[model samples]
Target: MISLNMLSLSLILFSISAAVFLLRRNMFIMLMALELGLNSAGMAAAHFALTNSQTEPVIWALLFFAIAAAEAAIGLALLIMISRKFSTLNSDEIKELKG
Candidate 1:
C-alpha cells in the first residue's frame, strides 16, 4: 500500500535532489544528490508498482538501484582522483580537463 506520506516524502526528496544538483558547486554533494534522485525515483517506481500490482516497475526500480550504485562508485573514484590533483571538489573550480 502506497501511503500519501511516502509519496510526499519521495516528492520532497526528488525536489531537494534537483535543487542540490543544479545549485550546488561541490562535486561531492552533487554526486550525493544524484544518488538521492535515483533512490527517490526508485521509491516512486516501487510505490507505483505496489499500487498497480505490476512487476515491471519493481524490476525497473531494481535496475535504477543498480545503476545508482554504479554511479556512486564511479563518481567517488573520479572525485578522489580529481581531489588528489586539484585539492578541491568545487565543480566550477575543477574545470579544464587534461588529456
Candidate 2:
C-alpha cells in the first residue's frame, strides 16, 4: 500500500526545492536547490523500486548520481573560469568580456 506519510514527505521535499529555486538569487544556492530536487526524485524512485522488488529505482539513482557529478564538474569549471577572468563568483556581477 502506498503510504500517506511517504507522499507527504515527497510533497514537502518538492515544495522546499521549488521555494529554494525561486527564492535564491545566487547561482550556488540555485544549484543546491536543483540538487535537492534531483535527490528527492531519486529517493522516490528507490522507494518505488523497493516496494515493487524491481531494479529500476537503483538504476535511476545511479543515473542521478552521474548527472550530479557531471553538473558539479561543469559548474565548478565555470566558476573557476569566471573567477579567474572576472575576479568574482557572484552571478549578478559576471560580465562576458568587459574585464
Candidate 3:
C-alpha cells in the first residue's frame, strides 16, 4: 500500500530537483539534478502502481530509466565538448552557443 507520505516525499524530491536544475550555474550539478528529477518521477509512478495494483507504472519506470541512461550519455558528451571548448564546466562561462 502506497502511503501519502511516500507521495509527498516524491513530490518534494521532484520539486527540489527541478529547483536545483534551474538555480545551479554548474553544468555538473544541473545534470545531477535532472537525474534526480527523473528518479523521483519514477518513484512516484511506482508508488502509485503499488497502490492500484497496476504494472504500467513499473514499465514506465523501466522506460524512464532507459531514457535517462541515454540522456546522461548525451548530456555528458555535450558537457565534455563544452568544457573542452571553454576550459570550464560552469554554464555561465560556457555560453558560446548563445545568440
Best by lDDT: 1
**Lowest lDDT 10-mer window, candidate 1?**
1-10
What digit string (tens of lDDT, one per residue) describes model 1 on residues 19-89? Answer: 99999999999999999999999888878887788999899999998999899999999999999999999
User: What stretches of model 3 exceed 4 Å from their correct place?
Assistant: none
Between prediction 1 and prediction 2, the one with superior TM-score is 1
User: What tens-digit string does per-residue lDDT give for candidate 2 at 1-95?
Assistant: 46445556667887899899898767677777888888777777777776778998789989998998888889878867767887865666865
Query: With candidate 2 superimposed using the best TM-score fit, by how many Å does residue 61's alpha carbon deviate from the native?
Result: 1.3
Stronger candidate by lDDT (1 vs 3): 1
Give the clashing pairs for model 1.
none
Clashes per model (N, Cα, C within 3 A): 0, 0, 0
Query: Mind giving the per-residue lDDT tens digits that candidate 3 earns over 58-82?
Result: 9999998998999999999998998
Clashing pairs in model 3?
Answer: none
- Report residue 47 deviation for candidate 2 (angstroms): 1.6
Candidate structures ordered by lDDT, highest first:
1, 3, 2
TM-scores, all models, native as reference: 0.89, 0.74, 0.90
What TM-score does structure 1 among the candidates reach? 0.89
Segments in model 2 whose C-alpha atoms lie over 4 Å from true places:
1-4, 87-99
lDDT of each: 0.90, 0.77, 0.89
